[model samples]
Target chain A: MMRQEAMGVLARANLEELRGALGAWPEPPDAESLRGPEAGLIMLRGRAGGGGAPFNLGEATVARATVRLSSGEVGFSCVLGRDLEKARLAALFDALWQREAEVVDMHLLTLVRERLAGQIERTAEETAATRVNFFTMIRGEDE
Target chain B: MYVAVKGGERAIRNAHRLLADKRRGPRNLPDITLEQIASQLALSVDRIMAEGSLYDRDLAALAMKQARGDLIEAIFLVRAYRTTAPRFGFSEPIDTSKMSIERRVSATFKDLPGGQLLGSTFDYTHRLLDPTLQGAEIEQAARADVTDEDRPMPRVTDLLAHEELIEGDGEAEEGAEVGDLTREPLSFPAERDLRLQTLARGDEGFLLGLGYSTQRGYSRTHPFVGEIRVGMVEVEIEIPELGFTVSIGEIQVTECQMVTQFQGSAKAPPQFTRGYGLVFGQGERKAMAMSLVDRALRAREFGEDVVAPAQDEEFVLSHSDNVQSTGFVEHLKLPHYVDFQAELDLVRRMRREYEDRTADEGKEAAE
Candidate 1:
């Protein structure tokens, strides 16, 4: 998979999910923290008319981290909410993926994508079930 | 007037202590957990988060609990925390078109492309309180039926715009400077961007009342609900080195599009003007009210006179922030002893002078 796609999957993964995905690895890689696993805020933006000029809607808490591996690959994580551990683990996984794409894709990206798809599928099915089946009444006849 | 009095330190300390005790209520009752507040009283948290202009669910829940369920106070707490929190950057504008909609319905069209899916709404339910819910153990929800046909959910406005039936062309100005009210102070004749930012975090009751005023013919807008969708949308941000937008995560949002009637001129045909509202969570009432106020505010854009408070941008935008309103109003609770003492002395002196003048006039009359 592409780097952006891989990063997107990693960023969306939660702390427990990211931790569970790490179990597939043989051992932790030689990674050093290049930057902090610090919590911060990101202002989420929206459009004026949902399709017009952009404006600030609100801010969401985010935790980010950057890691550099012995192999000279740099990994970064920027996920929603303030979970420093999740950011650190995701950064480490990014580094691991740069070296071993196949292994990471096989265990992590595929699973995350499938889980996301499953959620959308579930919501879509449930939403469709509640589709309104209404009967139109003639206004003058009713009157 | 500038006299500073001391000796309230001990009173203040004891007041806080009393407040803490009161917050706990009875010692026998268990403390309400943040998780419980976040889940059980979710709408309250949603309001707090939206009005506070912060989107951390857990923090909002904590604020609610700390404020003892006073939602406005909770919003104030969250707003205070937002100022101290470090800001990373702004995400790209969220696309509601590709939203994974959970609840979507249109009042204008009955059989629109996306069928009206009433996803977890309280619209049709009887308002009577369910006493059984006090200690109810709910059963598992029924499984949804599997479907292979993937129906595309298009915006109702987009459909009308295809035939040139709406005011907005539905095309955003490319490379336009996005306004951030935090970065700069909002000024007069504010564009739609700044107006949207203010309305997004504006007080629900204020907007609701203003919107209702428009309905009561204050600034009549024959409005129809084009669509209202509650769903999850992906938030993407561009990384400097990556050279591509990366999805941070999904956020639940509520969106409403209101269409109002506009008459055609001699050269132009009549078209439906649009108003938009988008909030952080499942804030349906806020969204609806915001859309109404938004359309009314567009009176000037449509060459109509701004005769109502809702149509007046300055009035709506200036007093919309409940935090600011609360600060100015609630500050009356603070000590104003010196100011009041000055008024007291002035009134006494005025009364003495008036009595002296009246006594002189009485003596002259007697003579």
Candidate 2:
């Protein structure tokens, strides 16, 4: 589960950040082609009122690629739009994390967590000014 | 007797040449570029994207250019282009509550938590043609008091739901698979997912007529527009290897929610039922009509007698595609000489027989 979460962060990470992180790692293991870095549409499903029954919202384009290491560990990467290189890099990172978790966990996972934390903080700050508060006052007429 | 028509290929080639010449129109006037269609004729592109079930604005514009600005034909072209594209992983459901709203309105309430923003709308615009716009220089107007506050707008339906006035939507079974209309043939008693999918890509005019039929007492639901929102929402996709979903991109969509009053049943209390409509782009009218039709089609689920044409799922879904309808209707212009010749021969023989009988009757009367 930890490895999976780390991979997810890696897959969604900024292209430059991901590339920079991967640049520090040692040579990657030989990966066999399992699936393509092909682009296609996926139907998005949503609840009626955010917590209701699931219904299809719409479709969005995505690019996905999968690679299997010689050690039998499989890595999959799916990203938005037609970024084949980004998908390949993500898949490779997934395989590396699976095979060398101790090394990747120590170096790459920490960076990913930091990046995500920064992103959440940035979004919160951006939206902080828009927060509205409503209240009611007690009236003496009621008494 | 009918002769076999020949040289159809040569005739078709010449017709194409003539159409090309006509499209150029003397080669003196400036040719309309794809960028103009993308920006100026943007609504047509949006419609094509909505009906075509594809969201690429540039591709939609290209399709409009290729189809010579015919919206339906452009939609057909986009749909054809989408057929060969591969399937990537499915995105996580969009949270409309977190939508960056450009337009939001509610007919049920006078004022709501998030005040209605009119945004860019033609609701107040006069329908008169402006001749000055033909060669007008466009400039962006600066608006006063632009707020930079980004927050998720609360839905009006939630307020009613808080009071238990509206029927609560039942929870879906976890990990249950959704039906894909593109992969499978549509069958009777379709699921809500398939129904919505069909309606999203359905011809707008057809849906409008069906929706109008409901309002004219066919299957009246006493609907009130709960909310109509047009905005952008971030799309996220689950990466199995990563064990979580990631934001892929943002897309513009129009969503409509219709609240209708339903009387108390043997099993349940009186509550407001919900009808939903969502389209690819900023297509408010299409979304509104779709919601009405969607509500009417739910007659069977609500245990009401299905006495209206709009209430019949098979009828509505089967005939909603304009591409299929146009092809079948326009195919009448194709070669049918043999069939017409046979009908002609039979009619001629019958006429001759009738004339002979009339002549015999006249002679008998004279004798």
Candidate 3:
């Protein structure tokens, strides 16, 4: 998978999910924080009219980190909300993915994707029931 | 002699203890967790997020819980917390067309592509409260099997734009600066961009009242709910080090596109106009109200008479923030002994002068 796809999934992965996926390696590769597991705010922007000029909507708390493996690979991850541990783990995962994409995909990336996909599917299914069952209020007025 | 009042420290401490007791609401009952407030009281969290100008649901929930469910106080808490965080770069403008929609509806069309989905709304429900819901174990909610196809839900306004029956959005120039209310104060006759930013964080009730005024013939906007969609949209920001954009997880948003009937102008032909609103959660009511006020405020742009309070940009923008309004209004409850004494002394001197003048007039009349 591409780096963009990998980072998106890693950022979304929960702490439990990341830790569970980390269990794959008998002994994890040592990673050091190159930048931050620091939490901050990312101002979110929106279009004026859904598709127009952008305006600042609000800000969301985000935690971002950069981790470099002892070898050479460096990875960066920025995720929504302020879970510093999650940010650090995501960064580590990103670095690992750069080194071994095939292994990370098998253990972590696919798991997060499948879980999120399932959630979206469940919601879409539930919402499908609510589609308006419309019939004409007046027979001639339907025209 | 000027005197200072003191010794509210003990009273203030005791008052806080009482407030804590009230927030907990009897030790016999389990306390409401922040998680529960985040999820179960989701609407309150949404309102707090919109008004607080922050998008963290967990923080919003904690604020709500701490403020004992007083939403204005909750929003204040969130705003206070927001000031401490460092600024990361703003995200790319969200594409609502790509939203993973939960609810989509339009009053303008009965049958349209991607039929209306009224996902989890209170609109049609009987207002009668169900007593069984009080501590009753809830059963399985209604669900249906859906096709795996992820169909593109085209906006109704987009279709109208194709026929040239509606005024196009007049999309902003790509490199144009969008206004930031938090960063800069608004000047008079502010552009549409700044107005939208203000409305997004403006008090929902204030917007609601203004929107209602228009319908009551204060502004007289013939509005039709062109579309209202509640869903999640991906947010992406460019990282300087990476030299590319990465998706930050999605945020749930509500967007309303209101179509208002427009009369033909001397220079332009009559076409439907648009009022838009997008808020940080399932804030349909807020979105709709915002849209109404937005259109009303756009009266000057359309060369229509700006006769309404909503149409007055200064009036709307000046008083939109509840936090600012509440702070100034509530400050009256604070000690103002010096101010009161000054006013009292002035009034006493004025009365004494009036009596002395009256006595002199009586003496002159006796002479």
Candidate numbers, best TM-score first, in rank order:
3, 1, 2
Report the lDDT tens digits of candidate 3 across residue range A88-133. Answer: 9999999998988998998888989999999988888778888885
Model 2 chain A worst lDDT run, 10 consecutive residues = A126-135
TM-score: model 2, chain A: 0.81
In order, what lDDT does every prediction score? 0.88, 0.76, 0.89
DockQ of 2: 0.23
- What are the per-residue Cα lDDT tens digits for candidate 2 across A1-143? 47546655665666776677677777646888788877787777766544566666556566777888888888877665567778777777788888888776666667776876675454444333333243356799977
Predicted candidate 1 versus true structure: per-residue lDDT over B308-362, tens digit per residue:
9999999999999999999889987777899998999999999999999999999
What would you estimate as the lDDT of candidate 2? 0.76
**Which residue segments of model 3 deviate by more than 4 Å?**
A139-143, B1-7, B148-150, B357-367
Tens digits of per-residue lDDT for model 2, B1-367: 3345687798899989887777667688888888988888877888998888877787888888877778888888988877888766567777778887777778777667766666667776898889999879987532333344434677777767778788765577788777777888899999777788788888999999998898889988888899888877777777665566766556778888888867687878788887878887789889888989888888888888999999999999999988788878877777788989899999999999999999999999999
Measured against the true structure, the TM-scores of the candidates, in listed sequence, are 0.95, 0.77, 0.96
Chain A superposition TM-score, candidate 1: 0.91
The candidate, 2 or 3, that scores higher on TM-score is 3
For candidate 1 chain B, the 10 contiguous residues with the lowest summed lDDT are B141-150
